[model samples]
Target: MKIAVVGCTHAGTAAVKNMAELYPEAKITVYERNDNVSFLSCGIALYVGGVVKDANGLFYSSPSELQEMGVNMKMKHEVTNIDTEGKKIAVRNLETNEEFEDTFDKLVMTTGSWPIIPNLEGIDLNNVVLCKNYQHANHIIEKAKQAKKIAVIGAGYIGAELVEAFEVYGKEVTFIDSADRILNKYLDPEFTNLMETEFENRGVKLALNQAVTKFVGREGSVEKVVTTEGEYEADLVILC
Candidate 1:
């Protein structure tokens, strides 16, 4: 039997490794656009803040590791289009700009959610980044070294934790969100108030009820974070 997996991230990697072990006689082909596989995106902020000593810890698997289990892992191959009716697919090799078609007896799609880019002005700024992967962790840490003031949008778990991490690195952080209170979705108002007060006391600005309308930048790098409340000078911006 032959099986084809569409992705190699968290869910996909887990599925492939389990299937390969359970069905040793089967031929497995895994397609991943990234050169590496099985990376823990959740630890990106910790890695950025130096809590994670080694960046290699972010990845749990590699193409060579999967290959050792008798799996054919193809890196830098993007599954551009799928024809489920025909059990065929169109793949593009990002490095060579080459395209081809392949057929499989069984197919699995583990395509993950992408970061929701807000329809705000100046989103194309250079210093603005999304903390979603290992590469992003490295770049965010490098950016923080030179940033005097940083602004993080969204007060979700990742956003809140990042604010605390960036603060430890001596970067002034302002967290902006449109909710009436911080972490309104998670904890009770009392707990949220306590956490919010602590964040504020730590010098991390909490701008609740304020929605960012635009990102002001000069020379393609973010300079100010503009919201309905007002504008705050920012040397770096992080979107979780």
Candidate 2:
């Protein structure tokens, strides 16, 4: 039996490993857009905040390990199109810019979520990053060290955690949200208020009830964040 997996994130890694163990005679192939797999994205803020000393610790699995387990790990390969009827797939090798096709008796799709980029002015500027993946985490940590004012757009779990991380690193952080309260959907008002108070007490600026209209940049780097309410100076902008 032959099996092909589309992604190599949490579900994909688990599926591929378990399948490789359960079906030793099966030929298992895994395609991953990234070179590394089993990255703990949730620990990005901790990494940026200096809590995680080594970035290598963030990855729980490696390609060599998978290969040793009799799994063909095709790193930096993207499954562009899938032909379910023919049991074939079109893949592109991102590193080599080569395209090819492969066949499988069984297919598994674990393509994960992507960060939604909004159409806003000055969004193409430098130091504006999306909080996802290991590459983005490394970029954020590298840039955060040189940033004085950091503005995070979105008050979700990731954004809130990033704000706390930046604060601990002694950088001024502004938390912007379109909702009336932070974590409105995740937590009740009472808990939200309590966390908000904690944030404020820790010298983190909360910009609630405001929607980001656009970003303002100068010399190819973000300088200010314009919102429905007002403008805030930010050397680095993170969209969570």
Candidate 3:
């Protein structure tokens, strides 16, 4: 049987690797838009804080490794559409823009979570970004070069770690959250309290329960972060 896999993150990478080893006779094809695969986005903060100096430490697997295991690895390839009726997928080479159709007896989709896009005034301005991939992490560092005050939105895993990293990098940071506390979805109030205290002790601004009304900017760049409470100056804005 022939199998086609879309995406090559945690889920897709595992599926393709297991299938190729378990069923060597069965043909397998893996499509990934990124040049690299199986990146541990969770470790980005460590990378940023200099805890992990090697950028390769963030990647879990490579396309060449999969190819060596008898899997047909197609990097920089993006699937445009799926023809479920015909058991084929329409795909394009992102680098070449060449389109092609591939047939398969089975299909597996492991598309991961997407970064949320918040609609706010001046959000489209420069230096506003999301920390989701390698490119994003690199962009964050690049933008920090000219920024004095950085504002990070959301209080999830990425947000918390990003703020911590910024503080370590000597960048004045203020974390904004709409909820009453940080990590409300995961940790209880008591544990969250410990974390809050740590951030506060480190001189990181924990702006909680403050709903952002808009992003005020000038010259197409972020100038201030406006919320229900007041406006805070920000040279760079990030969402995670």
Best by TM-score: 2
Give a tens-digit lDDT track for model 1, residues 35-69: 88888887877887889999888888888889999
lDDT of each: 0.87, 0.93, 0.90
lDDT of 2 at 120: 92
Per-residue lDDT for 100-132 in model 2, tens only? 999999999999899999999888999999999
Candidate 3 per-residue lDDT, tens place, 97-215, comes to: 99999999999998787897978888798888888988888788778878899999999998999899989888899999999899999999999999999999999998899988899
The residue pairs that clash in candidate 1, if any, are none
Query: What lDDT is reached at residue 142 by model 3?
Result: 79
Error of 1 at 44 (Å): 1.2
- Whole-model lDDT for model 2 versus the true structure? 0.93
In what order do the candidates fall by TM-score, top score first? 2, 3, 1
Candidates in order, TM-scores: namely 0.96, 0.97, 0.96
- Cα-based lDDT at residue 47, candidate 2: 88
Q: Which model is ahead, 2 or 3, in terms of lDDT?
A: 2
User: What is the Cα-based lDDT of residue 70 in candidate 2?
Assistant: 99
Which is superior by TM-score, 1 or 3?
3
